[model samples]
Structure formats: C-alpha cells, structure tokens
Target: MEYPGGTREGGLPRVLSDPARLAALEASGMIGSAPEQVFDDLTRLAVSVTGAAISAITFVGETRTYWKSVPHLPYTGVENWQNGVGESFCYFAVGADGPFIVEDAAKDPRTAGHQAIGPWGVGAWAGFPIVTTDGHAIGTMCVIDAGPRQWKPQELETLAVLARAVGNEINLRISLSTAQRALSTAQSALAVSQDLARSLQDSLLPPVLRPVPGLDAAARYLPATGDVEVVGDFYDLFHTRGPWWTALMGDVCGKGTEAAKVTALARYTLRADAGDHLSPAEVLDRLNTAMLAQRAPRYLTAVQATFRATPAGAAGRLCLAGHPPALIRRAGGRVQQAGVPGSLLGIMPTIRLTDVRFRLAPGDLLFLYTDGACEARADPHSPLPHRPIFDEEALAQALADTHGLDAAATNTHIAEVLAGHHGGWASDDTALLSLRVPPNP
Candidate 1:
C-alpha cells in the first residue's frame, strides 16, 4: 500500500550486526514456485520498473543458487545471477517478515566482500527475499544498479510488493511447469518461447532501410521492458515507385503480441496504400479505413510521412493521425515540429487531415517517433513522474543541439538523451526514424 521511504521499524538501524535480522527471516517465509512462463515473466517485471541493469530470481538450493530468469547484466548473455555460498548478496538479503534493501552494496560490510558487489562496481541494490508460504528461501526479486545511490524507502517497498506478487507467480509457474513436464520435459520450450517472441518482434520491424538518393537514413527500435517478446510500436521505410522513400512509425496503445500485430499492420499498410493516396493526409485517411476494420477500440495512432532525397538534398510531406509530429531541424539554428499533427488513427470519424510540406536543403534533419521515446521515468515514485516529453521548445533545442551530428549520429544522440533522462526503454516500446539531408555537393 505504501509507495518508497522509512524503515519498517524506525530503530532497527542499518547495521546487520543484530540477531533480529536472523529471527525475522527464520519466521514463516513467503510464496511458492509454479511454472516457467510466469516465473520468467515476473523476473523480467522486477528488473524493468526498478531501472536496474539486472533482475532475476534465485532459488537457494542445498547445493547452489539457480536463476529462473536473468534479464540483463554487466557482461555477456551467457550468464545468470548465480553465486556460491556467502557469495551473492541474497545470502545476506534475508528479512524475517517483509522485504529489505541494500541501497549501496559497497557501503555494506556484510555484502561488500561479495563478488557481485566488490570487483564489479555494483553499488546500489534493492532485494525482496521471496519465501514459500511456509519456510523456504525460494528466491529474491531484486534490482542491481552499477553505481552507489541514496535509495528512498518507498522503492524497497514497491520491490517487496512485486516480490510478493512474484511469490504467487512462482507458485503459478511451478504448477504450470509440473503440467508442462507431465506432457514433456523439454527445457527447450523456454528457448522456443523466447525465439517466437524474438521472431514476432523482428518480423514486425523493417530490418533493412533502403538508401535514399541524397539523405542518409538512420533508425533504432527498442523492445518493451522485461521478457515480453513483442513490442506494440513499429517503424519502417519503403522505396515507393518513385524517388520517394516513404516511412511510417506508430504505436498500439496496449501491450503484448496482439499490439505488435497491429503495429506491423500499420507500418506496412502505410507503405502499400500510401502510394495510392500520394499525400500524407490521404495516406492516413486510408490507414484509418484499414485500422477501423480491426478490433481494438482505443488509441491506435500513427504518423505517415514521405521523404524525397534528390541531388540537391531532400524534401518531404508529413501527416499525423493521433501521433506525435516530426521533429525538424532547419539549416540555420532553428528547430520545430514538422507540422500540425492531428488525432490518433481511429479515434474519430472519417476526416480530412492537413499535410505539412517541408524541404531539407542540404543540412535539414527530420525525426519521427512514438510517445515511448519521450515518456519514461527513472525513480518511478518521484514527486512527479520524471518521464521526459519533447514539448515544442525542448524538441527545437534537441534539434538545434544536433547541428553537428550526421543522420545516424543524431539519431543515436537522441536515443542516448532519452535513455539518460528516463533510465531506459522509455516505459514502452520505442521506434525512431530519422532523415538528414547531406551537404550539397
């Protein structure tokens, strides 16, 4: 119920030199294990919201610890959150009743000697030890920050809440796993699940962006948080019948594979039908007609824009339907949204949209994105959600700032800025596409 500060007992103190820490953990534990899918999902959920580099579940078995899901780390993909006796922070992460945290692991004597903390420069950690409803130290739902930090109490509480939920999920996973084993003990199923998610995601995106005549095209698409495979947002570039290189970016308001499907539909439909419509406005109109035939009733938004990179440089037309407008940087020192973006694709009846015409003479840059690029938070419980939004002025500043970066460089810079502002992943799937007119020959 509580949202991040204060100790459970005011005077318990931060020192682990007390017998109470032992007594508290020795009491009845918290959850049970269930199936692999649910276990994998919760492990991902823990790392995501916490803005940590790693999130995983560790089962402290008689021999050693095993990871249910290890999402990210300071190293390569061939590892999990495994540790030996008294080696992992979880060994000392036990709490008698609820959850506990190590805001700065290097500062804590008991865990400072641990490998996951000492040599790795790991300084901040929030751990919620999960126990079977009875008395088993099943695992912990925790976040690991590479550097030291002053963590608020509410953050630990949220981790505890998620850890408890993880308990339920563990039990669910164990149950599901039992049934899964009954049918087949193929551990490969997990790999398959991961594969399908990856395929669905990759297939939805435009893997290769064809080269335009004069402008350098660049883009980046990031997946959603945690283990979920498919992202609800998509972006792509299509070489039409003429010199025009049509590009589209959009987001499905919801989550999961279903949204991914819708996003793919939007990306391609804009390509296949935009040629028939010719202008950005007509393209969106036709898009709405295509989307209205689908099932989801809410915010199905998209931005359809076309760029023609010629010998002298590039020019384009952009139309918006309930999506954020394009960020445009002029040759001089000015920046602005490319045009007046309209409503989302399906929110209203059939209406004519206005197309914003633009010409990128030699150094002009254009950027299009979903809200996820701008809206994300680091310390989720801050007084105000610390997510970043590129309001007109800020967008202009970003564009102006990118005067020296090439198309790809500028695109990367924007991504780094967004990630730095709100941690990572932008709370949702992020799709970004940029076009920069090269210097006149």
Candidate 2:
C-alpha cells in the first residue's frame, strides 16, 4: 500500500502501508494537542508500527539536535546536547523533510564516520521530518532498527504519510497544554467564589439576637437551594426595650448581596423601633416606612411582628406585616394560625399592619418560617407548582404533626418537610424559626 511520497522500509514486519488508509488518517486529525504534538505522536506510533527499538522526532531550527521520540536512545531529552546536529540521522530527516531511510547507517557516507554513530553502533535508521502548515520543516518522526532492514515502498510511504499527521499532532499538543491551564484556572476561581459566598452568608446572621424572657426561642437559617451563596432570608429574636421583646422574620425578593443588605436593614430597623410602639401593628407600620425609604437593588417581601409576652408565657399584642399568619397551639392541644395579615412590608410604605390580640398560653408553640416552608416542594412536578403555599390547613397540620418539638427537632422537621416538598431540593433559601412558649410557674 502506498500514498503520495514513497514506500516504507521494513525492519520487523506487518502492513501499516495503504493509500486509502493514509488518506483517512491524514483527514482525521490529532486531537487535544498542538501541531507539534502530531509529530511526537507519529514518532511513538512509528516505533510500534515499524517494530523499531528506538524512535524520535526532531524539530529543525533551535532544536536541530533534539530527538523528539527516541524510544531506545540513551540519555535523550532536550538537554543532552554535547554533540553536533550533523552526527544524527535526525539531522538528515530535516534535510529531506520527508522519509529518509537507510538500511545500514554504519556504511552510509552521510553517517558512517559520525562520532556518535560509531560509538552507539547505530546501523539501520529511518525517519521523516514533520512539516508545518506554513511549509516549514519543524520536526521529524523516525525509527531506529538495530539490525539491517529490507525496505518496502508501502512501509516508507506509510512513514511519510504518518509524518504529515505528526505535524498536526504537534499543533494539537500545544493547544491541549494551553487549554488545560485555562481549565484549571477557571475551576479554582469557581471554588474561591463558593467559599467566599458561604462565608458571607454565615456572617449575615447575627451571632446573637440576644434572648427574649420566658420564650424558649431557637432559629435556623439555611440557603433555599444548593447555592451556598444564597442570602436575603433571616430571623431575629431579641428583647425589645421594656416588657416587650420583638421577633421578626422576613425574606427578600431575590438572593445574594442585595437581599442580604435588605435583611440586615430590616432586622436592625425592627430592633430599633420595637420599643417605640406598644402595639404590634405600630411596629410593622414603622418598618414599612423604613423599607419604602431605602432605595435598594430590588423590592422585598417580608413579615415583621412584635410579640408582647406575659408572665404566663403568652403574647399580649401581636402585630404582623404582609406575611403568613402565625400557627399557635395552646396547651389544650387546639391549633390555629393567629389569622393576621395586612400587607407585605417593603413593597408599600403606608402598609396596614394587622394586630392579633392573644395570649400565648403556657405550653403553647409558635412556628415561623420563610415561604420555602409552607410552599416547599419535593418534586419539581409532583402535582404541585414550584411555590406551593401551605395555606391555613397545611400549616396547622404541619404543627400538629410535629407538636411539642424541641428546638433541634422542630427545625429538623421543618428542613426535612421543606426538602421533601421540593423533591429534595429547596429552590430558594429556606429558613425556620421555632419557639415553644414555656409553661407558667
């Protein structure tokens, strides 16, 4: 089998020579590397195809003495440069820039007297230079047979065709090396971004909301979804001036730094204004004013409420902004959402806040959460929409299902239920705050 250049020289045995096959190989280029890689690959393949003990690919120019793929050559890398380029068959390949096969190099005038050839006892030598697309003889793909060889036209031609492939392969190697470095850099950047987001999200949560007396309060804030960078959802519980302690929970429209800012603003505003109003409704009204005044990145949906606790462990005045009504279960075991909703804070400044007058009797509980709870989903398409609302019925049932749950258990239940609802995925940041009103002494 023969392609365009010349026949192949046989040293070991077999049939890698065929014109149709050479065409196929030439068209189907080397991948994952630069042009120079093509030559290197050709040299290695030549060693296997020709059954030669040694093979090399040499680039002309500054790398004249360099053997690209010397399989059985001793001490061969780019640095073994104690000899002249004229002493090598690798140099002759550069002159031919194609197949240059010698059955016995010891008697060949071009290499017979070569210093390294005599010392190394090199006899049979065959090689071809790899030419670049620009027609420069950049490198050679060659094979060294220790003994003599019967030359075959098909074999030598196959070697030449393979040399062409090596040119492209060399280019591919360069490209691959460059691409690998780029990919590594991108992955590192992504990891760092994730780490920073997690740090920021954690820092957004206040270390201590302090403690509200007589109220066994505990809260958990988690990302709505897999994005560790999530922000904008939070819960706050602290002693607000006098006999009144304010507890407010809210979420922004979106997730990230913008949302985080709004959350911080809302929490601080509630704490500052909690003592200003004796009624829960008044507290929300003030918060509404605050939200409208700030020009943030986006609008927000939030629930801000103040609970006046009695020594009996019940809330005296409960004011709520636009948000889910509270779920209350008395010691007697009856449960209901302290139905109160005026409007969502932040969206409107002159929002009307509703106040539910009630006492959180001893041994009662309050369930607070972001929309990720009631509307949480388990399946993206499990006979439910993405944001399924818990409504009044669902909320009551959830509380009843986990009645008298301690801080850890209650939060865990909430997380699992939310996860289950979303098909094991909370599409947004889900937050849960559960408190059990202590029994009266």
Candidate 3:
C-alpha cells in the first residue's frame, strides 16, 4: 500500500482521510467524558475472557489513541490515557475489517517496531474494531499480554461480541443525549428543577458508609419511575461515639427543592444530636424541635436506631415518627416488626415518641425501609379496578424466606422482589438498609 503524507519508515502509520469516520466519532460526544463503570466492566470481562493482563477500550482519533477505559491502570494524576496514533496496536485494529491478532509482537512484522512494544512490554495482542451504526470503524476493544502467547479462536469471538455490544452502547448514549438536549429546550423549567433536585438529594445522602465493628451493613436508594425531580427518600449508616453506631432511614412529605431542604436538615440534626450520646427518641425529639423552628411547609417521617455491642450480640434502641416499623429476621427464619407508632415530625409542637429496644442474636438480620417498598403496586399497568400493594406482611414473609443470606445479598433479593411486584417500575422512591450480626465463633 502506497502511504500518503506518512509511511512506515518514520514509524508513523499512514493517516487515512476518512472524514465520515471522524465525524461519527465526534458526534458521539464521548472523547473526553468521565470514565463510566459500564465501560470498565466491559474491559474487565474482556480481560477475564482473553486471559490477558490488561484490557482497554480505545478510541482512535486523528493523531492519538485515547483509552476510554483501562481497568488495571491507576489514574494517578493523569486524566486520560493517550498514545501516539502510530504507537498503539489499536491504530492498526481500527483500520482492519474484523479481529486483529498478533500472537508475538517481536516476531510479527506488523507490530515488531510499534512504539508500545518497548515501554508497555506488550508481547501479544488481540483487538476488535468497534463499528458504529453507520458502518464507521472509530475505535477498538483490545487485550494486551506481557508475554508471548497464542490467541485462541474462542477468545477472538468473545472480543468481537464485546466490541459490538460496546458500539451499541455508544450509539444508545448518543441518541439519549440528543433527545435530552431537545427536551431541555422544550421544558427548560422542568430541566432546571430536576437538576436542582438531583444535586440536593445527592448532597444530602451519604456517599459511602463506614464499616462498624461486628456488623455487616448494606444500603440502597432507588429513584422513582420517570423521576426527573428527586423524591424524598434517604438513608444513612454512620459511627457515633465509643461502641455506638446509628442507622437512619426517612422520607420527607414532598418533592423538589423544598423537600430537599427538609431532608438535609433532618439528616444533619440527627447526627448532631446522636453525637451527644442521646437516645434514639431524644434525637428525634431534638430533630422535631429543629424542624418546627424552620417552619417549612413539609413534614418528616423517620426511624432512628442506635446500636451498641453486647455480650449476647448487638443491642439496638429504635424510635419511629410516623414511619414504617423496622423488620427483624431471626436465625431460625422467624420475622417480627419493631418500633413504636408516633406522630409525624414538624407537624405539632408537642410530639409523643416511643422507643423499642431489642437485641440481635448472631446470624440475625435487621431491615429498615421507606414506605415506598411496601406500598409498591403489584401491577402498575394493570387494567383492573384495583391493584394490590406489596404490604408489610409480604415484605416480612420475603425476609423470612431469605433467612440465611448476608446483608448485601438480602438487600439485593428484596430489590429484585420489589421490582417484580411493581412490574419493574415503582411510583415512589425506595430506600433500604440491612444490618446483620456476624456469626460468633
């Protein structure tokens, strides 16, 4: 092939003039976006299937090959991984029609003098071009091995399949972005409200939970269907003073910025009060006082539980304010509800709150959730006059059936059940927290 502008002599691959390919890639709007877990997951799967030490999703630009995802490489201070167009195996793969495999770079004419061979120590490689819906090959899904090895036929097939899936995902993202842009112009006020709600909700919720001694904990927050604006459900698990830990789950009365303000106040106030070694009921009382002082047009329903290590296992004091009762699942598969009924917060100056104290034995589980879980409709799209709610009894039964599962597993199972009951769409936000007492030796 007679190269134009550049040739192999200068260690630069011939630059092909494919304007459509470059335009398609630019239109996808994915060149410099933040790395997403979905792409990293694909790269990880590629590494596992190909038995390669490193895997990456690479986009071949005009003068550089940008790595969309490199699972094993640390970001350090670098924002994105990029290499010269002539230096990467993906550069050649992007021009190829199908899977490109070099079993031994040192012995292969096409890759022996490649720039990546020396510094990156790439001895073997397999890459499949990621083709767009319009038939433009813009990038590649590739696997790299440090030592010489033979590429298996099955591995090549798997890489090709993953590449197609990546291409589809890129197309879907592009289409969704285009639609959102069009919608934003039409519904500017709604878009702004949604953005504000999402930002506020995210800021108020705990990003990560700190591990507590002798307890296994997990939590999840699911937004409602068509939830452009954020709902009021939130949960948190945090450590308190010596040997004390607290878990909170709550729901504010409304949606949007007003509800978000109340949510923030409730979470922070509870944390502040609990730090004084106050009981769960006392913390709620203080929070109620704070909410009333604000005089906001919103009410709050919540459950606050303080736990401490005990000789038997873990002891907890739970206080409820117009909130769903927490469920306890015993090691022997029995389920019971705990927490006293009380009036809603921020509604009245004088509120009567009750506390329920219980001890969790080894292998027992504690579950706290928002009302959305039990109130989820069994069939959201049903034409019948009435649709049954997946009530508390149903939730208790499900927990009893999943007796031996760990905290994370139990939460996942419950989410799946909720999805199934609601026909895969809930009308309201749902938050769940699960705590399990570790088995004693």
Candidate 4:
C-alpha cells in the first residue's frame, strides 16, 4: 500500500496487513458484522472503568478500521463505521501487538504529528491488542479521552484483561462453529465468561472502605447464590472534601452488564458531585440529572449521607432517592429510621429530594443498606406453605442487637443474620455500609 506521505518503513506496520492475521480475523467473522450486545457491553465497561469519554472495539484491516462496537459513538451504517486505517489509533496497538498508550496525543512524540489526533479528538489514548488463540493480533479495545491525562497502571491492566476476554469471545464463536467440538468448547466458554463476570463485578465495588478520621467504617457486598451473572448492588465510602465524606449504597434495577453500567455511573457521578455539593440531596439530585442525560439503561434507588467528624461525634445530611430509609442505632441500642422517601432516579426529569440533617453522637451508628436486607425471605425449599420475610421490623431488631459493636462487627453481624434468614442462599444482591462514632476514650 502507498502512503500520501511516502512509506516510513514500507508503509504501515506489517501486522496491520499480515495475511495470516487477516485470515484469522476473517474466520472470526467480526469485521463488518452487525453489532453484538456482548461487544457493546465490553465497550460500556471500558468507559465505566476508565471514566473515558469514548470506548470502542476496532478491527484494523489492510486499508480500513472496522468498528465492531462503540458504546458512546452515534451509530450509522456499517459503511459509515469504517475509515482509512490511518484514521485510527487502533493500528498502534495492532502494530505493537500489545498495549499502546499515549497520555497526551498532541504532545507525545509518537503521535504528535499523527493525522487522527485532530479529527478523532484524541488527547490521551490507551488500548490493548485483541489476539486470536492462534497468536495473531487482529484489532484493539481502546478508551479515548478528550483531554490529556495520565493512564493508571491498573486501568491499563484491566484493558489488557478485557481485550483477552474479547479474544476469548471471538475464539469461542469459532470453536462453536465446529460441529464435533461445539459442546465441549461451549462448556469451557461458559466457565471463562462466568469467571470474567465475577472479576468485573468485584472491580465495580470498593475492596475496602477508606479510613475516615475519628470514625470507623465498614462495608460488605454479598452476591446471591446460584447466580453467575453480575448484580447491581454497590456501596462506597470516600472523602468528598477535606474533613467531609460521603457514604452511599444503591441498587439498580435488573442484573447483568446493563445494571453494571448504571452502577458504575452512579458511583463515579456521586463521587464527582459530592465534593462540590455538601447537601446529600443536592449531590444526589445532580446524579439524577447526569443519569438521565446519559440515558442510563436502568433505574436505581440510593441513599447518600455526607458528614464530617466533630468533637461530639459526627454530623451530616442524609437523603434517599426511592431507597429504603437508613437505620440509626443509638449508643444505648435504640433503633430509628432516617431520611425522607423520594423518587427513584433515571426515569423522571424532575425528582423530589430532601436533605435531612442528622447527628451521630459518640457511640452512635448509621447503617445503610439495599432492600435485600429488609426484604430477605426464607429459603425457597422451606417446608412452610408461607415463607417468612425478614422485614424492616426484623432488621431494626437485628441492628438494635449490635448497638455496642463497632462498625466492622456490626456489618459482620448483619450479614450473618441475613444469611441465616435466607438459609445461606440469598435471592437478591445485598450491600451493607456502616459508619460508627467510637465511644469516648
């Protein structure tokens, strides 16, 4: 192939036009193919993971880059989705047969003079090559930012992992095409997909609560048994600003990757807005607007509390968006509900959110949870004709029993209680967060 600027070293990288690589890509049947939901989900997950403006799966052919999925880009026709190979950053990953990263496209020497930098609005770019099982690099899975920023190591690693997942999906398709090996390969693919789902699901939630000065905080996420797909429950504890922090718990409707998209958006949006807005209601209200603007695929209910440590204990504002009211366990074991009920988010243009002020004196604790706690039901195989549900009253009693326990102990006790109620087989995803002010020392 001839280049307008003359061949730098026999034109573009040979891998972009490798005969064997092209054969593998053709065998995969992804080029110029109709959009697949799984590919789209991966793109969405890319955006969610990196908080990037755009994410895409592109096949770098001899002369054109064929887009298999671009979650944020407006879709046209298949012809419109393809562009000259020179018009994409994907070829960089394909050429390297590995990850291609540029923190600042316009300033990075490797891409400063690149033509795609201007048209594609490339600033910071990171991508990993999607390689076939037979060791042919076919394309790339990438994330794009409109402005320059450094990519984190973990973020790049995740892109690499997900790129492998894309490769696996493509190879799985090829394997299933063989009549004799279909059943055996299909079973293996299911196991790989389930394992990937679990990894991605864990990435969506915080592994450990960030320490809050003068307070003890703890959280847990319990996935339902017998379900391999990801669920929507999530929780977080982070500093909104100096001395002020936000604790949140939410449940998006439905399950699978669709719900994960919303869960990630809610969590990042809340963190982004909480620092600027002290009112829990104001921050949550802004999150609602962001969700609606993004056309979030699922609706979610959440409770947010923004508070700061005080000499007496902690003081904060709390709000609920169609979520179960938070339970407060007093120093002496009295349990009470907090927050005014309001509308859920992502479905309405106008929402009702009220910030109710509350204080956590020394030895008090605020417990936030998803409906899974209050609505937990007995095991499906229970012999009783009518199974018992661990309702709000029972939950309150459970919280009251943990009055003197610290945050970590409180979370553990509640999880145990819920597990016992459901016979170790919860039917819904559950998230629990607790913030406790230690007793005076």
User: TM-score for all predictions?
Assistant: 0.55, 0.69, 0.57, 0.59
lDDT of 2: 0.64
Residue 160 in model 3: lDDT = 89
Report lDDT per candidate: 0.66, 0.64, 0.84, 0.89
Off by over 4 Å in 4: 1-181
Candidate 2 lDDT over 64-137, as tens digits, reads 24444444555433457323444555646655545677887777765666665665557788777676544545
Poorest 10 consecutive residues of model 2 by lDDT?
10-19
Quote the RMSD, in angstroms, for model 2.
9.5
- Residue 50 accuracy (lDDT) in model 2: 77
What would the per-residue lDDT of candidate 1 be over residues 346-377, giving only the tens digit for each residue? 65566657888887777777888877665544
Better of 2 and 3 by TM-score: 2
Residue-level lDDT of model 3, residues 1-441, one tens digit each, is 222334444544343347887888898776765567999999999998988999989888877777788888875432447767777778776666467889999889877776789877899988988888888778899999999999888998888899999999998987888889888876987777778777777887888777878888999887888857766788988888888999999999988778888888899888888989548888998889999898857998999999987777799799999999999998888999999898799999899899889889998989999998888885546664565788999999888888889898998898988887887678888999999898776
Shift of residue 275 alpha carbon in model 1, Å: 1.9
lDDT (C-alpha) at residue 228 in model 1: 55
Candidate 3 Cα misplacement greater than 4 A, ranges: 1-184, 187-196, 383-387
Ranking under lDDT, best-scoring first? 4, 3, 1, 2
Best by TM-score: 2
